[model samples]
Target chain A: MKITILGCYAATPRSFTNPTSQVLEIKNHLFLIDCGEGTQVQLRRNKIKFSKIKHIFISHLHGDHFYGLVGLVSTFRLLNRENELHIYGPKGIKEIITLQLKLANSWTNFPLIFHELTSKQPELLFEDSKLSVSTLPLKHRVYTNGFLFKEKAGDRKLLIDKAEEYNIDFSLFKSLKKGKDVVSEDGKLIPNRLVTADPPPPKSYAFCSDTVFDLELVPMIKNTTVLYHESTFLEDQRELAFPTKHSTAKEAATIAKEAGVEKLILGHYSTRYENIELFRTEASDIFQNIILADDGEEITVE
Target chain B: MKITILGCYAATPRSFTNPTSQVLEIKNHLFLIDCGEGTQVQLRRNKIKFSKIKHIFISHLHGDHFYGLVGLVSTFRLLNRENELHIYGPKGIKEIITLQLKLANSWTNFPLIFHELTSKQPELLFEDSKLSVSTLPLKHRVYTNGFLFKEKAGDRKLLIDKAEEYNIDFSLFKSLKKGKDVVSEDGKLIPNRLVTADPPPPKSYAFCSDTVFDLELVPMIKNTTVLYHESTFLEDQRELAFPTKHSTAKEAATIAKEAGVEKLILGHYSTRYENIELFRTEASDIFQNIILADDGEEITVE
Candidate 1:
């Protein structure tokens, strides 16, 4: 899995900086997250194929998070996209989009699907043969949710040498890979473990953002391979984070540490700070493995 | 009056080229026209004070014309604007904006006034002591209107020497400036024209965009100081322009000639062309004075 940070700054989009938006590429899917204003232009600048974006996930209704949605939808129409587009966002998203389209009289010719989320608990959002996604409820000034994406466990790898020695037929190898015993031509049973090895462990990534310092998400995101969390402020401004329902670098690192994630990626820094090195420094003190998220940066999940 | 072209290109906002939007500075007022996507960023880059934009006029319901409006409005709220904001657009604009505000649950603390335009004919929209704005109906793919801003005729320059020579009291000076004959203290009538030179002729600017080449607007915008017309394509693409409800450079120049405007400013160039000099050359064939509007270019109205 690979993740590209199109934009990661908090609040308003500046001439040099952008707001929240990212592209998570898992398996065959290129999922867009939190489309802020000018996200389409960022996508163009980043050279991301617009048609590759089939699914979009919006965290909340904040203008900084989803203001670019309507424009993106219109752009898709202008590009003559015919594939279905799925949007998963907080409730009221459908109304906002529908009203804008109606006013413009430019509804998409392609099918635009909406999945309005209002659940307060962690609920499964999407699942396929390769990957599964679920929501992690977050505490913010408004209704918000973070996403957790995990690669599904695959079939065991068959030991070709052992299978040949056991006289296992090529057709029976499928059952052996499924951890099933295979019967030879002589009607003798061959144990699955003797002919196959366990497949590599599935990788998982969890995204957290626009939330206050709370440990409630730790259990849901435990043992994640890569954990991307919002670190809006530094440790010195922890007090200011409370009322705004934002997290400091130290707090985000604490969550990463408590969850036992392999690596912690920090982003969504407030524009008030001239530089974001302080966030990384503070987070690094708490969590040794830290990756700073920046626009145009791409991180590959191992 | 100063006109700042924040965005002048047509179609979607690209990485370098922006869509339609401009800032018209008339006296103390800063009026924004046709806010497309990424306009807020353009405003920030241009160093235009956000608070100074109290009134906004949207020409049509096309996404390129009005998509940036909601984001700008939300940005104003985030900036904690105390001044009232007045938006004038198509009839459905209010619903589109109000629904988004409701979905975000982000109501502005300041007053947000919406003036929805539905008139098919030209009508007055805004007026102050110094200037007035009216709509000039335009033909487009959707319901659209162009704006005409004219500086109200100023008071006649007070000639102190002539007033004193005519024994005109200070009280009559106001009447003389009003182009009224003043009765002197000697009971003799002093003609105001003889005492005072004519005030500078009122300057007018007409803005027309997203419209086809129609001669009906000639009488309305006749003999204007500066006329801005959309030149989305060059003469080579004139055949394509009619179906798209857009004008070519030659067509826009023709309108300027028929209107007898002093200066013609051409904008809204389609992104398909690599160079815009061809547009200037094509327009110059019909009109002598042509100003090509580019992003960040400012034209002073005399």
Candidate 2:
């Protein structure tokens, strides 16, 4: 999976910085996450194809997270898009978008689907043959949710050298890959473990933003391949984090450490800080593998 | 009054161009008009004080006209604005803005007042001691209105030379300046014209956007000091103007000529045309004084 950071600033969008927005490409799907005010312009500047965005996931209804949604939908209509579009966001999102369309008298010609999430519990929001998505309940000032994308387990790989030495029946290879004991022509059982090796590790990615320090999420996001977490403040101002329902870099790294994630990517820096280096230096003390997410940076998870 | 153009492109926001948004500064008031996406960034780039904008006026519900409103309001709240804000827009605008704020649960401490105008006839939406604003009906695909900002007539200019020559009484000077005849203490009637001269021409600015060839507005905006009318297309694409409800350069000039405005400014150009010199030449054929409004350009109406 490849994730691209279009913007990472918190609160307001500045001339040199932008608000929250990102693009995650898993398998053949391009999922847009959060869509701040200038996301479309950032997309254009990054040379990303606009039509490739078929699904959008909004963490909450905050203007910083979803202000670009209405304009993007309208631009799709203006560009004569005919493909069906799916939007997954908090409740009341559809109403706001529809009201604008009604007043403008410019509804979309294509199918526009919306999945309003009002639940406070962790629930499965979307699933397909290749990947599955579930919500991670987050603690924030408003109704908010983080997302976890995990690849489905695939067929097991065969240890060709061992299988050949054991003279395993070639026709029974499929059954062995499915973790089934195959019967040889002589009516003897061949254990699946002797023929097939364990499947490759499934890749998983977690996205968390606009949330307070909540350790309960560690279990749900255990052993994630890559974690993108919000680091709105530093340890110096940790006192203000809980009251605002935001997280500090140290707290974000603590969560990543508890979850045992392979890599931690921190973003969503507050505009008050001139440099983001403090976030990396601070977060690195808790989690060894840490990287600062800059606008236009792309991270690939194997 | 000083007017700053933020975005003027007719279509979508691109890396090189932007959509519709402008700032009209009259005295201490910073009146924002038509806030398209990326307007906040443009405001930052131009070094305009966002805190001074206490009022926002939208011409229509088109995405290009008001998509940036939610983000701007959110930024204001994030900055902890203490002043009340007023928005004058078409009917249903309040519903959209309020719904988003409700969903986000991020209400502003300042009052957000909305003046929804649904009248087809001209109406006064805002007024103060120095200025009065009224809507000018326009033709478009959606419900639309143009804004006309006129400075209230100032105290009549005192003809100091004439007053001294005629030995006018200082106490009667106020009544004479108000265009009233005064009776002298000796029972002599003196015409007010002898003591006072007409006030400096009250400056007026008329803004018309996304409108078709509608000559009915000429009488309403007749003799305005500055008129900004949409010239979305050139003379070559005039055939497509009627269906789109947009005016060509020549048509905008014709209206400017019939209205006899002191100066005409053309903007909101379609992105299809690279060169805008054609609009100037075409408009100059009918109107001698025409200025092309580009992004960040300032127009001072005196």
Q: Which candidate is the best by DockQ?
A: 2
The C-alpha lDDT values of all candidates are 0.92, 0.89
Give DockQ per model, in order: 0.72, 0.73
Candidate 1 residues B203-253, lDDT tens each? 999999989999998999999999999999998887889999999999999
Evaluating just chain A, the predictions reach TM-scores of: 0.97, 0.93
TM-score, structure 2 vs. true: 0.92
Top-TM-score structure, candidate number: 1
Which residue pairs of candidate 2 clash? none
Model 2 global lDDT (CA atoms, 0 to 1) = 0.89
Instruction: Write model 2 residue lDDT over A89-162, tens digit each, in one string.
Output: 88888898898988889999989999999898888978988898888888888889999999888888887786
TM-score per candidate:
0.94, 0.92
lDDT tens readout by residue for model 1, A163-191? 99999899998898789998987788998
Candidate 2 docking DockQ: 0.73
| Residues B35-62, model 2: lDDT tens digits | 9988999999989999999889999999
Enumerate residue pairs that collide in model 1: none
* Per-prediction tally of clashes: 0, 0
User: Could you tell me which 10 consecutive residues in candidate 1 chain B have the lowest summed lDDT?
Assistant: B97-106
